[model samples]
Target: MASSRFSAALLLLVPALLAANRPLYAQTVTAGPDSSAVAANPVADSLRRTEKLFGWRVTRPKKAALLALVLPGAGQIYNRQYWKLPLVYGGLGATGYGLYHYQSRYKEYIKGRDLYLAANGRTPINQLPGAGDQVKKETSVDNIQRGIVFYRRNRDTFIAYNALLYGVTILDALVAAHLRDFDISDDLSLRLEPALLPTATTAPTAGLALSLHLK
Candidate 1:
């Protein structure tokens, strides 16, 4: 009888102790709704940033554009516009060569501009041993520096043109791929035909008429 009473008293005391400690323990707990939202915000922001950089793009034109930006002719190849590859390569090669050529000339002019002029010198280009005949007309210290500026500007221009061509290649691929599925059969066309009509106050007589119809 004494053991049974001790067991019943232990069970009652355990619940009373837990009830008294519940408030204090709950104060230390951080699994509440506000805390959970705050914790999840960082993960949400990380995923959002990742999505901004590498979101899904499954379209052919989009893929072609990206491929063209990385590789010039690859997009055209993807679009089955193999003939455009030659034009792309040709424009790039020509602009690249022009940029190189102008850069070399600009460097040479810079060197010429830095040379000290002698009192007896007639012209700057004539004073230099290996100067080209092109600068002989404007052969002065100031003129040589000006030529340097001109050639440098030309080099920069060619570089810009080259970049423009690269961007055009990408745009061409995008447009071509986008229009690949467009209808181009004989059923879709314009036909011109002769037509005659009477005006409000005039009769139709030898009037040149035109009509356009498409299916």
Candidate 2:
């Protein structure tokens, strides 16, 4: 009798135990992330996965461009291309120096011309701002005016050069980043083969065919 009572109690306890664990089982099934849902949503998937540079998640080209825009040579450094730094800096430096030189000369000529005119033709051309014997040896108003124009033009040219070189460096960084994974292996090949060509005259002709293979 006692055994039968214990068996009845166990039977009741089994259903109660199952009822208590059912919600927990369902909770466990729903707790973790749903990979299929994440995969189905492209924006969520992209946000979940990212390419990183310098601990920041960003595409290579975009990162390189941002770095380059923030500071020159930073992009090349990020790309691990140390050699290009010299060329980039050299071009910018040369253009910057030329800009400084020409701008100074242009300003000097302008000042000299203004001073000559202000003195009401009494100031000797040689005694002008830039024509002070120790500086530029400009002797005539015509020569001073010509010098001003020449220096101004050269300054403007150097300004263009500086802008061009700066842009080139930024573009180089962007392109280099894009081509970082490009394949230039020996698998690329060109071949010449003989082929038959059909003509409108209903005759077949022999021809040499050139084929390019990329693998």
Q: In terms of lDDT, which candidate is strongest?
A: 2
lDDT score for residue 24 of model 1: 15
Displacement of residue 167 (Cα, Å) in model 1 is: 2.1
Candidate number achieving the greatest TM-score relative to the actual structure: 2
Candidate 2 per-residue lDDT, tens place, 1-215, comes to 54344335434633443343221111112221221212222233345334676687877767887788888899899889999899878867877898998898888888878888898878787765444342247667888889888899888877876776677677777777766745455788888878777788888798887766545
lDDT, candidate 1, equals 0.64
Q: For each candidate, what TM-score against the reference?
A: 0.56, 0.68
lDDT of 1 by residue, 1-215 (tens): 54344335434643443343221111222432223212222223233222111366346667778889889988899889999989889878977898899998898776665442543355446656655555555646778778888899888877776776787788778777656644433665454545555678677644544433224
